[model samples]
Target: MHKASSDTLRVSVVVPVYNRPSELRELLAALVLQSVDSAEFEVLICDDGSTVDLRAVVDEFNTMNSLQIHYFRQHNQGPGIARNLGLHNAGGAIVAFTDSDCIPEPEWLSELIGPIETSSVGMTGGLVDFRTADHLSGRCVNYLMSSMLGAGGARDPRAALHMRYYPRAGNTAVRRELACAAGGFSGQRHGEDIEFSNRILQMRTKIEFVPTAVVVHNEKKNSRQVAMEAFQKGTARIRLAREQGVHELIHTLPALLVVGLTASALTGLFLPAFSKIAGIPTVLYAIVLALIGLHGGFLLKDVRALLLLPFYASLMHIGYGAGYLYAFLTDPSTSVSLERQTVAAKSPHDGMSEQ
Candidate 1:
């Protein structure tokens, strides 16, 4: 751990990392290129018990740069807990957060802190998008969970359909005092940022959305990884509901989709007489999914990715629905294994919509 003397820093960039040394290096390089002066902010890297010695990366970067950087390590806790460690040691009035895998734009820090500095808002969340849309699987997955499909809340304030707009830990800035007073992060393996934002909202603290403050996530997920991430996200939603009573009918849409598809298939095979009527929902769903895929493909400018979108979305929906149903069936208090699954899935704080 490298402890630097605290100065009158204006912003503290808190980044929680785990087993991503290369990504951390990239983030550090990007931070050095920020429009905000190096003297105006500091970067704190909180390690979440990775097998690799991440300190070496931080030290190597520090030797060549003038950025004020501090490193902290803890046991294998979730990103939420690791972020709490950063928040506790933050030396600035404003605490900005971004994942190690994200490469923030030059104006990211400036844009994020600008609103909070000028307005009375307690926190602000910026935009998170893909570093690249070249990969077919990754692009399809992004489309499936994006605002275009009404399944995500990371890009815009109106993106969220199932949950209230909340700042994600990956690209958010909060007043140091207000975040600490709200009790920091909840230490959950997933959805901890949303829970934290919920607490901030309970305090009636306004959270603004800054579209220009952007971070490009270096996403490199395979088909399996995409499906597994969706599954973990679904399970995490249930956990949030159990703990916070945060429920929305839209959250159950995937599960209902699973059930409805299953029924339709079974009915078509076993009871051929009503197969046409039973298949109506399936046909309609396919049309909607196709339209979404077409739109995604147009935006990505990739025909191959568009064709693969439907299959990718099916995997996403099915996996998420299954996980949701599984978690919903299991008791929350005794769902130790489910929580472990979340960590195993390496679920990061997802982007939420603006309030």
Candidate 2:
């Protein structure tokens, strides 16, 4: 994923911003200096109804004439809908997406679009590295949900997905046509990217990995934020699980609980080696249980925060469980609706269209 700055690439950068004022400002600053030719690119910044005044944030980038940058304000409809609106307003054949909290490398867009142009792939995604340990837990949870959420994963998690790739909605690109054809992000608050990726994979669309298209996800060091994030993520996971018809996520808790209890009970009666091994997972399981018991209300993913690795994973399981229960009781059907209006294309489907 070498940078392609020689030729001008017209990219419609879509960023969905919320209340994060300072971060958004930093992101805009980074966008201002991208290795891609600013003159050839356009930016559509959708304000996802921030409670705070973000005018200054947008103002920092809006005054620039080097690139066409515009701002749209929408009531909080969650990030999915916010991004979908940006998708509708984009003007470049190549649509690049990133979160407001993310800081893109100078070559971010160039590298992402470069591979897609060369390979003629319909869409692509990139890797996200957290900035600090204060975000380790939330960051780790992001890793766990990556595969299930269509955010892209290492051939193995142990592989760390560090090898360069694409498919994640955040920090990724799509052929404007492909996004338009499949419909845009669902209005749901969560798992919209998962649904979109599943649609692409189901269609056997060619998606490539551009390892060089990297972004630093400045993860939340705040537990409350992490907790709320977890809750929302839980809500989304449940919705997506039903959508995918995968019910195992819903039952993971009871099953894990049973495993924990059974392992605890059986450990004392088993031979030494077997007993220790049985106790290990059980001990880890109990650690998760204890964390939730102690700080179930908190949200940050850092060590001092409420969600630890095992506990955060467990909380996610709980959220999915509760989400599944609610969905099953409400709508048992996970069928995709044909009525889903395809996202109206604001630009040509250069990257997503068949060459």
Candidate 3:
């Protein structure tokens, strides 16, 4: 990559880190290999109160690559706050956000920046994908997320037939001034990216979704972690809806499936004939998931991964459903009201766009 003066910089790649020095190293290495000129872009690593000293990792990269890398340290607030610090300190006109665990493709920065610079759009985003499945949980989650039944639409805008594409921090770029005008991220731990995107929408800022700007997410979580992520996503959706008034019916599908399956199983225990009828949903769901798993296995050449999909799918759906129910039923109005208060306390200009 060509190196130029920092005065000519066009993009600021902001990554928030939290106790993941090794992952941060990998991401920094990938950033050094970006197709964009090294001087055209700079990196700001915002540490979110990590117990492990991450400065060494950033310093190592800076020395080895002679890259324009800056590091900031803050108390353990959250990713949103850390990102805001990066944004505030960034000097580039374009600000790109990605996670510490993601490794961007060579063309990732170039691809995302081209659209944002050439067009009238205020923001652009790319696909967050997995190149390999190292573990069973990764395999299962990757397979499910890549399918139409899962978040294929979310990962690729062309496939978003029913779902709308939102700019996630994991692979998104925005005009720095526009983002600042929109009040930056809202500091929500779970769905801050989506919440920030909603504010961008309120500004009527056009966002382009570019599928080629790929970032390989190095997610190596166990089954329990995967389930917990889904559960948190479920709750986050509700919180976002309450705060942003952006609701999607598709988010409730898993919860509905959970309720239906539970009711059907209970009814089947009392009526033997109804048991056969009740088994249809479960059977069909299993068969479809199994088929998806088989397809994944065929593509990856791993039969063991195929066998575990159904169980993983069950965990994803049930955990998400339980979380959705818990959030929705646990003093719904009070949570919404309190959330508003908290947001107001944190940042007065968070969700409001410049009028």
Each prediction's TM-score versus the true structure: 0.88, 0.71, 0.89
Q: Of models 1 and 2, which has the larger TM-score?
A: 1
Rank the candidate models, highest lDDT first.
1, 3, 2
In model 2, state the lDDT of residue 34: 90
What are the per-residue Cα lDDT tens digits for candidate 2 across 1-355? Answer: 1122313546789988888888887788888889887767877778888899876666666665355566777888877777777777666777899887788888898898887677768788776654232246545555444432212232113243322222666778887778777778777655567677667655677877666787877655443554455456545555655566423432345334554656566875776667766677668767655554343223333444343545555555544445444445566566434223357754432232210
Model 1 C-alpha lDDT per residue in residues 1-355, reported as the tens digit of each score: 3334445578989999999898898899999999998877889889989999899998897798778888888888888888877787777888999998888989999999998999899999988764264355655565565554636443456553434667888899998888877778876677778878877778888989888998877767877876787788789888878766666777888899899999999999999999999999899889977877787778777888667877777777788898898888886565332231111111111121101
- lDDT: which is higher, 1 or 3? 1
lDDT of 1 at 215: 84
Task: For candidate 1, list the clashing residue pairs, or say none.
Answer: none
lDDT of 1 at 150: 31
Q: Model 1 — TM-score against the truth?
A: 0.88
Error of 1 at 324 (Å): 1.9
Candidate 2's error at 255, in angstroms?
6.1
- The C-alpha lDDT values of all candidates are 0.77, 0.62, 0.77
